[model samples]
Target: MGGGADDADCGDAENKLGCILSYNSHVELCVVNYTMLAVSLVAAGGLLEAERRLDPSRFGRKFVWQAAAFMAVAAFQITLCFVVNCSGVSIIWNAVVAFNSITVPGDTPRHFLFMYLLAFAMALSLDVYYAFTLELLTTIAHLCSLLLGGLGGFMYLRAFPNYGRQLRRPLLGAWNGDGGGGADDDEDDGSTNSSTGSV
Candidate 1:
């Protein structure tokens, strides 16, 4: 964890290796230092599982878009963080966390909403504080990661809301479904399950 808080050359041996390895020392704290690759794998798995639970069918088709979005976020954050703070930034886990903690179906229960907001607040606080404290680039990178995730999630729902499954809610509570949030999964997750019940 030799990656300093504000290294002049984040690419220097002491920082570059650490940056790429952990993306930044403050990231998973101690978890990423020794196992960055493992962490990335786990993040991706978690994202996929969460998506699977949203709609149990046609996971194969959806995988293409999900995978593309994941790679795009990771690459963008990594490049931006390294350039701005000489800090390596890995958005894989961050994006996954953001999407899961924030995406919820309507009628998802009030308790679930509370927990999601709590998690999001904590994450937002950290990013905002870092940005205010002179790590603006860090905040930017992190924000991009979150936005990309949220956007991709909405798109996913709009495209494939599943023809017969009962989706919890619309994207952000009012977008897809009769309101299509989930079919091509790109388009029926919101018309009220009085649906055709097609399999």
Candidate 2:
């Protein structure tokens, strides 16, 4: 009756993520959806920050690169939702599983379970906070991240050369070189010559 795998707490799903949704083989559960949404959000902010540092021009460059990065991440997320098809095998959802494994359900190292619950609570709290703050713009941004993340995973199968090549070509062609949509050619010209004209 002490610290065994068959303890009642060990058998409870609530001891894990407490997921409620179940679709089918597609997404099939709340765990995958929750993790994908979280991942897409994080990836979007990282992309925007990277672009801002690399090309700090504020005029309109921010708009173009920011948009593409969000869209690409979105596409990847969406494809992940539908195509991944099973949360049981999902890398994202299994993060919870792995964390939960830190404490055997019926074992004495109960602090790990406390840590997991604390982390989950904090994540859910932030989700609620952001949900209340979201508006039309951010909502669309979320949807686009879903679509782009999905597309990226899809293209991973086909092995595309660039991230969101199609999105960047049309949206950002005017801002960069490679002759208006470098869809067909490698983006580098490898020239070191520089000249300036003064009047």
TM per prediction: 0.54, 0.25
lDDT of 1 by residue, 1-199 (tens): 1122553335554556455545344554434322433443444454455455555576677677767777776676556545644544435555655655444444233334444545455455555555666445555666676777777667766777552243444445523223233342433433433376533
Per-candidate RMSD, Å: 7.5, 18.7
Tens digits of lDDT, candidate 2, 1-199: 0011112122234422121123232232334455544543443334334333333454155445435544543344334434422112122322322222221122112233344444445444533443465334333433343344344435432442322323333322323343222323323211211222311
lDDT scores of the candidates, listed in order: 0.50, 0.33
Candidate 1 segments whose C-alpha is farther than 4 A from its true place:
1-4, 14-18, 23-54, 81-85, 101-103, 107-119, 161-165, 168-199
lDDT of 2: 0.33
